[model samples]
Target: MKLHISFKISAVVLVLFAITVGMLVDVPRLDILNESIRNLFYHVTSWFAMVFLFIASFVYSIRYLNSGNEQHDLLAKIFVQVGMVFGAAGLVTGMLWAKYTWGAYWVPDPKLNGAAIALLAYLAYMILRNSLTDSLTRAKISAVYNIFAFVMMVIFVFILPRMTDSLHPGNGGNPAFSGYDLDNTMRFVFYPATIGWILLGLWISELRFRVDSLSQKMNDDLDIKSDRLDSIPRLDEE
Candidate 1:
């Protein structure tokens, strides 16, 4: 696997350092959340990173539609793929934090359910995209779907959660972690953690795109050689 220099390795090291500090640093033991407040560094930051990744994907999709550039289409797909992983991580960490705070890994809150549905929408993209065989058709259709998926994600993750009363913080009139929980102290770790994860996501996406590009080139070369060989006169055909 080739590591791309575009993301830079120092960012990864900084992220690791930030994570270590987040783990060792003392956090406020607030009501219900207790020691689990440390999860703010990870759970919240992962969602932040996921949102950034999805936003990039949405932008690339739009570019693909306007310019008809296959690179934009590829970027749109790669960002979605990486965003989904971070989204899943956020969900899992939230579940664990919920287990500690709410006493259940699964809950009936609108926020939680909406997040799950949003992820499902993106997962459908992979399935729908692969079902198409033509590259042009696949790119156009997937680009349009990416825009739809981003809208769906915003509605499910942000809009719907606030529409109803819920146990989750930042929902049902409850103040968000930043409003009352996160202080300047936590921000030191939290901000860096978010930046680190975003950089890491971009790094991974770059490597994946490079691998895909090389694979596509190899396939195209093979197709050209096959065509050239077929054009030569065979004894039977002659």
Candidate 2:
């Protein structure tokens, strides 16, 4: 499917707005997380986008399993690939935020550990895909793995964080995004930033899908041409 121009436009607009407002808006001067709190707009938004992309991939994997269509499989793979990019960005930003706030880049926080494990799990999925030689088998197995990994990722990133103690906000005794942490001013930028990053991820996945589709088509055409050439009977026997 062709990507709509409006989607691209909206992503650009929202991202610009996020950067502008995130920098311009005056946040309350907290003890350690004074200016660094602005990372919330970029860091949190990237993870939100990653989650959105993974959800899209998970749905496409289900469709692939039901219909056995390679297109759906391709869509699922591309979505995960894009999701990983955003996931990596989120990790980097989170590390930076952690360094400033927690006095260390790598902490024993459950949420942080969960995020790392989730990313590693997805990376393992990619490795599994590459290890397979048969296209159909690869698609089927990877689809199943994708669903399983996604569920585990959700449990790791969302469930485990809340269940255990963590220095990150919105967990343990820390103040959540609501109330004072994310006041009226920050909300304006945060929501749009999330939507914008998700849209951008979708745009990237679409582009990758198109390229993969074209390559598949070209390979199929070559195979058909080779078969046709092989079918022509030689006159040597007659």
**Candidate number of the best TM-score:** 2
Report the lDDT tens digits of candidate 1 across residue range 52-131.
99999999999999999998898899999999999999999999999998899998999999889889999999998999
TM-score to native of every candidate shown: 0.90, 0.91
Model 1 segments more than 4 A misplaced: 1-7, 227-238
Number of backbone collisions per candidate:
0, 0
Model 1, residue 3: displacement in angstroms? 10
Poorest 10 consecutive residues by lDDT, candidate 1: 229-238
> What shift in Å separates residue 118 of candidate 1 from its native position after superposition?
0.8
**Which 10 successive residues of model 2 have the least lDDT summed?**
229-238
TM-score, candidate 2, is 0.91
In candidate 2, how many Å is residue 82 off?
0.4
lDDT of 1: 0.86
Please give the distance, in angstroms, between residue 191's alpha carbon in candidate 1 and its true position after superposition.
0.5
Instruction: Report the lDDT of model 1 for residue 140.
Output: 99
